[model samples]
Target: MAPLEPTQPDCVWRNVAGAGKAECKIWQFPTRVSRCTDATNVTGFTWALTQTWQPPEGQVYKLNFDAAIFANLLASVVGVIIRNDRGQVMAALSLKGGVVQDSDEAEVVACWKALEFAIDAGFSDLIVEGDNATVMKSIASGQTDLSRLGNIYDDIHCLARGLRYMEFNSICRSANGVAHSLARYAKHLDEDIVWLEDSPPPALEALLAVSRLRLNEELEFTEL
Candidate 1:
């Protein structure tokens, strides 16, 4: 009987023998290890927190909208970005909206503004997307909302009727990055800003990032 020894740098072997029978077992440690020195370092290695925005099919337009609440300023900002099947920006809006009590209300108001903007810009076929799942669900439900934000919902539905085609979709915050950027940028503005067939400076980077991601995905798919 001898003491067990490590056969490899990260593994140890054990043996037992009795009555001419022998058995051996080995335990191995993880081949690789990682340590987070701080919160910033830990977050740097985190998986992507968002998904890439997808283009609409056929002639439909994809509209991504988001809201940023400024409680201290007693106001909220709504951002909307519309793109065509080829991911070309058809329109974008960063509007300063009225005060809302919470994020949910703000989101509803953003949706309303987004639809209104789209209709005004003469977009008929739309696939509206937002990161707020509850708001998106309520809008897609097609039921008369009796909640406090019901009036806003009514306005949204009314505007939706003006469109030849309309859809409400919920996406992750990362997927709606362009709109989110616009909403935040609205905080520095005194009035609403609209861009037709282009995006504002603040949203340009995010829009390009999404475009690049879309291009990469397409290339990968093509390669496959």
Candidate 2:
């Protein structure tokens, strides 16, 4: 047989009958993932959604979340801060209840408040983001075997049903850093919600400064 001639790129050769090398660039951009969730996945969706974000130039979004996240009833706080197309805070929700729990009531109440706020703002469409992936799945699936969460899930659906358009999805913890801060801030407070448009707490500020220093050190190390 004769040798094959070159075709496109400056590479060695193209794969005609055989497979090609597998190399793909991976990026951590957030997007929507639908679900028809069962009972067990209810809480995970709620926590998972906190780490997600969508690009600007989209419709208004309402993220219902808890600051004190309870996976197996542990004391892990979670929060969500959602921004709209205008970059204003569309919703900032945090929660901390007894025994470090995933309080369906907390999620429901927060969802209600956000829904009310969105309605008042006259947003026609919305995307509900959450930290708990399981909760998100349950919401999308339209049912759950969990009694307590089931009730709140119904409430969430009811609220969402009233919306002109809406979506639900999940994200990772690093992606939901802002919301995590807000949730921690909310959980440790003595009284009602605290709104911050300008600054974060002093501890977070210090932590950020330290992080910047570490990054600088890393850059210097790499240069060497």
Q: Tell me, by TM-score, which candidate is best.
A: 1
On lDDT, the candidate that comes out on top is: 1
Off by over 4 Å in 2: 1-52, 62-66, 69-78, 86-124, 144-146, 194-224
TM-score of every model? Answer: 0.75, 0.51
lDDT score, candidate 1, position 38: 22
lDDT of each: 0.71, 0.45
Question: Which clashing pairs does model 1 show?
Answer: none
Q: Which stretches of candidate 1 lie over 4 Å from their true place?
A: 1-50
Error of 2 at 95 (Å): 5.0
Clashes of each: 0, 24
Worst 10 residues of 1 by lDDT: 12-21
RMSD (Cα, Å) for all candidates, in order, is 19.2, 15.4
